[model samples]
Target: MRILLAYDGSPAAETALGLAISRYGDDELVALYVAEVDPTTYDASAFGGGTDDVPDSDEAEAVLEEARERAVQEGYELETAVEQGSPSDVIAEYADEHGFDQIVMGTHGRQSISEVIVGSTAEQVVRNSPVPVLTVR
Candidate 1:
């Protein structure tokens, strides 16, 4: 069984990783971290309107490294990647393209208004993914 684990270094995502390890220890585990690019973060810099520096890839790498270490501690070796895109789209597409048997992810558990406005990445992935998705809160 090939399992794709969506990790972002959040507490919830870590919990999801743990669940994946515990449930599918022998399966091939792929840890994926989507470094969502909010255009607002770079728009100003791109236009040279502000002095704020464009963020580096270091942060994304750090998140993946942490996920890798955690999986190692759980006795599961994982393949990892840091992708740039919307979280839900990247996760769902990657799972589908790679032919993963399942996808494990975490939800922020936001409430009504906030959830409606910002939307839930896990929920979107669950709805769009071609494979089964297991979401941990």
Candidate 2:
């Protein structure tokens, strides 16, 4: 079985990655980070200024890099992808196109009010995914 792990370096996402490794270490593992490009905007700051030390672009790349290194250390050959698109759509499409047996992701655990306004990516993926989706809190 192949597992597709959606990683963004959030604590929850890191937990999901760990769960995937622990449960399906013997299977094929693919880690993906969607860059979440906003087609309407070009200002980099739009993606930053959230109290994170690094810029969003740098942080995204850093997280992917760290995940690759961790995978290597864990003795698994990880297929990683950095893509430009909406997170839910990109993740679901990639998993389907690649024939992944399962999809693993982490949720920010947003409450009803925020979810109603912005919608949760995990919720969207779970709803639209072709395969089983495991969401780590």
Candidate 3:
């Protein structure tokens, strides 16, 4: 089971990792950290953690390191990447490109008009993915 765990260092994403680990065991997991930086745009602010306190590159690196450590502690043979693009597109493309058996991700739990407008990483991935996607909230 080549499981791709979409990690953002968020609480919900952590839950997704936990679920994947518990369900599929550590040996099958791959940890993925996407920077989601809009490559065409020169502005870095449009992507990354979206916090002024942390620079985009540094923040993404930190999150990747944290996820790697955690996955290692669980005994998974983990792989990582920091990509620049739309989150949903990157995730789906990576899964397709690498031939992952399943994709695990977190949903932000936004509802109503806000969710409809802002959209969601989980939603798009589930919709556009060529493989199976497990959404955790």
- The candidate with the higher lDDT, 2 or 3, is 2
Consecutive 10-residue window with the lowest summed lDDT within model 3: 46-55
> Per lDDT, what order, best first?
2, 1, 3
Candidate 2 stretches greater than 4 Å from native: 41-58, 109-116
Compose the digit string of candidate 3's lDDT tens values, residues 34-69: 665535655655445343323365777788788778
Cα displacement (angstroms), candidate 2, residue 81, comes to 0.3
Kindly report which residue stretches of model 3 are placed more than 4 angstroms away from their true locations once superposed. Answer: 43-55, 109-118
Candidate 1 accuracy as lDDT = 0.79
Output the lDDT of residue 10, model 1: 82
lDDT by residue (tens digit), candidate 2, 9-95: 888888898888888888998888777655566444665633232236566678878887887788766777676557888899999
Candidate 2 global TM-score: 0.78
Q: Per-residue alpha-carbon lDDT of model 1 for 1-137, expressed as tens digits?
A: 99999987888988888899899878899988776656655453464532223243577678778888877887889898776556788899999888899999888632345446867888888889999999898
Q: What is the TM-score of each candidate against the true structure?
A: 0.80, 0.78, 0.78
Q: Model 2 residue 110 lDDT?
A: 24
